[model samples]
Target: MRFDYSEFSGDQGFLSPDELFAPPNLMNFILQYGEQAMDAMANLEDEEEQAFIQQLIDAGLLEESTDEDGNRRLKMSPRLLRGLQHRALLEVFAEMKQGAKEGHSTREPGRTSERSDGTRPYRFGDPIGELDLPGSLQNAARRQVHRAVEEAREAGVEVPRGLRLPIGITPEDFQLHNTEGSADCATVMLIDLSGSMMRYGRFLQAKRVALGMSELIRGRFPLDTLQFVGFSSLAETLHERDLPLVMPKPVSIRDSQVRLRIPLEQAYANQEKIPLHFTNLQLGLRQARQILSRSGAANKQIFIVTDGQPTAHVTTHPATREDMLYLVYPPSDESSELTLREALRCQQRGIRIASFALMEDYWGMDWVGFIEKLTRLTRGTAFYCTSEDLASTVVESYLTGKKSKKFIH
Candidate 1:
């Protein structure tokens, strides 16, 4: 987007014209993940890379200042990440439309309907369209007419001044129009925590995916919510704060570190193991259904990150004798049948399930066949990703994917 040079003509101070528009996107990413971006920038010592960085700084996309050593360092600004860019875009678009249709009725879109549902109480700066007509007219008449009658003799003016248009709408006369807003969306993320995930570094992969996806959602979709669930022997939900530290302990801390030792001792003493049901695909699907069933958003989606032979039960109710069992005596009934059952469940609930799997381990590699079957049955896509790019792959796909309709039970 080009910055309007004319808008900077009368500016009295520091910021240049290019700087005004450049800040939004730059500020957004910075506010979303501050130190991460700065640290990433630190590693780029090439002149071309530095120049590219400066372009962003000049555009006001980045916040830059001199360090104690007098060297310039770059960082992202927070305002851009908080929907300011979107809001500014909306405002500019509205202004453009208004300018194009100037002199036409300023009637708002979807207004003129009789429903009082849109009526909002008066506020200090609201425009005149927002006024309660009866109250405003009553106040105006009392001031323009009744006051004239009561004060005419004292003012020494003619008994009635021919009709007056009560000096154009005053600041107090402006009334704001009220409108209803749509509800926010709620999302649930399910990650595979089966034994196989440990083999291919899939667990750590899922952690990165969770962190990046959360940041993305929190930034672009401010009104939406996200929940993370990891399932293995059983499903355990994760909190946002837990994502960054999910992997190995900080290697810098020595075993002799007193501070770390104290905490470790306490944590281990009180550590409670969350329930883990066998990689029961059936149980996870059933639980996910129950979770999505209660969400109040207009839409919902489920993302499963895993690499395992789904071994859970299938039916919503007790198993019947005829419900075929394929494995016995140290049974390995790792059939695709149960996966099909879960896919059907997701479909029935109008839930879209996107699965991310890895095939790096002897046992985990079987996940390829299982994920293929499930993705096809659920009408959701499957991804085969490397550990490094797993998070990016999943997040990119989700943010750009078509939004699906909410399934009603």
Candidate 2:
């Protein structure tokens, strides 16, 4: 067969390698554009284009899903979502070059047979087979030399041959190699879906980082727990399959200096009439805290990724203690203060928070102080970077800030 090469054309052979659909590019496009990309699929009219999409369905990347109206719609298959997550993880790891190993390390040792870097004095019942022979023998020889010198000196011996101290291994000289420690961790990642996040490519990068974190926990630290919470006017737990379709809620109300409050129950009843552009950090933190309270993991963490400060916060009525949602434009003090208060509550519950602030096209560091203050209040960590560096920054923060849980013996 002769080699065939030509300029790219939409009418070219479908089976040709060059014409074959690339899954990564398609997935990336879908995730980057979110729902809009999926909607675009309905506009294809050519048979070849339809065949191309059919190929994706056949490959198990996309599937026919029904909407609430019982209409057939194209939705991402779980396999595709997993592939994107795995790709994001690989990209982040590639950028980081070297990082922590797969499994989380526990502070307590001697639970497993795998050897770690350090050794400790052997205790009764510790497997003798795991003893560090070199260390044990060294200890025995050192004690022997010290005693031999003392005996020689006491005898006033000036012989060329030096007398040695106690020689040979004893129970006291046995040392065991410290076994590898592994611990499970519960992590909740708060992603900002505020209108501002749709700018500077912030939303896409944050979403990518979240997906990457999911895969990292699932593939490497299987024992660790992971969840993603996207917060706008309210917080909602996101499933892995729906991540690619996620997008920042558009700004429906643009009025300046606005203040509104709705009872939580009423808000749920009129969810479709509610605005979705406000940043509700308070509810997000609370939801995460509540989710983690059920986990028995050794460590718990909350990762916050946002491009702006909280523009809204959830509260309770003073007298009835009824749940309420508050929205304030331009991020009023009431909103920020409430968000910080929620963060303090998280701190009291022993949840570690790491806030990643996206500073692309931002006016000043002053605007970013809310998250910084929240971090300080929680005694957590803060990272500032542009959308371009968000993935690497988040990945590095997660890997380096990991703390092993200590076990009570």
Which one is best on lDDT? 2
lDDT of 2 by residue, 11-67 (tens): 764674223333677868887889888877745779998898888777676777778
Distance from true position, residue 136, model 2, in Å?
3.5
Candidate 1: residue 42 Cα off by (Å) = 30
Look at candidate 1 and tell me the lDDT of residue 297: 66
lDDT of 1 at 257: 18
Residue 115 Cα positional deviation in candidate 2, in Å, after optimal superposition: 4.2
- The window of 10 residues in a row where model 1 has the poorest summed lDDT is 253-262
Model 2 weakest 10-residue run by lDDT: 400-409
